[model samples]
Target: MTMTIAFAGTPTIDDAPGIDWREQAACRNHPEPNLWFPVGINDPCDDAKDICVNHCPVRETCGLVANRTRERHAVMAGFRCSDPDEFIDLRIWLGVENPARRTRTCRHCGVKFSTRHPRRRACPECRDLVPLEPVHRHIQHLRNVGKYTLRGIAAASGVSVGTVSLLAKGQSPYEGPYVSRAIAARLFAVTTEQEAKTA
Candidate 1:
């Protein structure tokens, strides 16, 4: 029996009658094949993706197949549709329903905006409004001059020992659920008082 893959706008049959469609994939020759299957959201895949998508001759076909099959993992045609909803959004942006239209609704503010990057969910306005990293020096001061241990800082300011450790080590103190401004202010006041007593 002959099998045909159907894309949203057009259908293309796999060339070798009985063979699987993936056998004809353009990314089959990649050096680090596992790089395509990134484990985390922040994992680096751009180098492999560039070869698989931009350099591949069958990128469009790959995208069509990926979208049709509702692929949840792996990059296809430079797009990583992590879920069915993301695939639908990709199709809409690809102009499956309307060829002339190419826009995506921002995940944050629900504003429609044009984007060449398929993975971009937020509009420029919302992207710019994202919070900047907190100043690490405030935490450093407590550790350096105030001589506060991680446990001591955690006890005094109610910030976690892990966060205090990161700050003391000159690492990202503001990553993830970090010390709040109120807690930081309290720590700053405590450090200032310590500084005054030692002076």
Candidate 2:
């Protein structure tokens, strides 16, 4: 696959006539491109994350580009290149640090679409139909009954701390009105007391 990644100086092949978000990328002109790719290993896990999470304004767009072009294991998005076969294997791919795009069928409408998120199983309109109250109730149970903090729940549930925070606030910032079924399953599966570390 020919990927025209508009990273700093690189020319993009699919200039679909919009503002170039790449210019705002924090990794622009970095000394080592592998600091982001690290296709050989998964060690660039920390500092790079700081750049994307703290500085990059176009982090979402960058991941979208990577997913759109199928950049073949490149860590254009926040996905860690830790596992050697991250490109070939999907099982090793985990939560929170999710980025990049892949094609998935919506479980609700049976519509196929491109998504950069691993948890997005339904289209936006159908996403609301997925019950989120159960997930929130479980989260509350974990917090109130189990005495776990939001961060603790985030760690155990494989969901982001920000997502957990939003859910507590009766908001779903990353998702529509609900989290994906996969995410819900993940939250429900966190019965381990230790995994749900106390704050």
Q: Which candidate achieves the best lDDT against the true structure? A: 2
Worst 10 residues of 2 by lDDT: 87-96
lDDT for each candidate structure: 0.57, 0.60
Q: Cα RMSDs of all predictions?
A: 11.5, 14.5
- lDDT for model 2, on a 0 to 1 scale? 0.60
Backbone Cα, N, C clashes tallied per candidate = 0, 1
Candidate 1: pairs in clash: none
Instruction: Let me know the TM-score candidate 1 reaches against the reference structure.
Output: 0.44
Q: TM-score of every model?
A: 0.44, 0.36
Put down candidate 1 lDDT per residue, 157-185, tens digits, no spaces.
Answer: 65557755665555543334233344455
Candidate 2 local lDDT, 39-83, one digit each (tens): 333134456667876888876666555544555545655654343
Error of 1 at 25 (Å): 3.0
Error of 2 at 132 (Å): 41
Backbone clashes in model 2, listed as residue pairs: 42-82
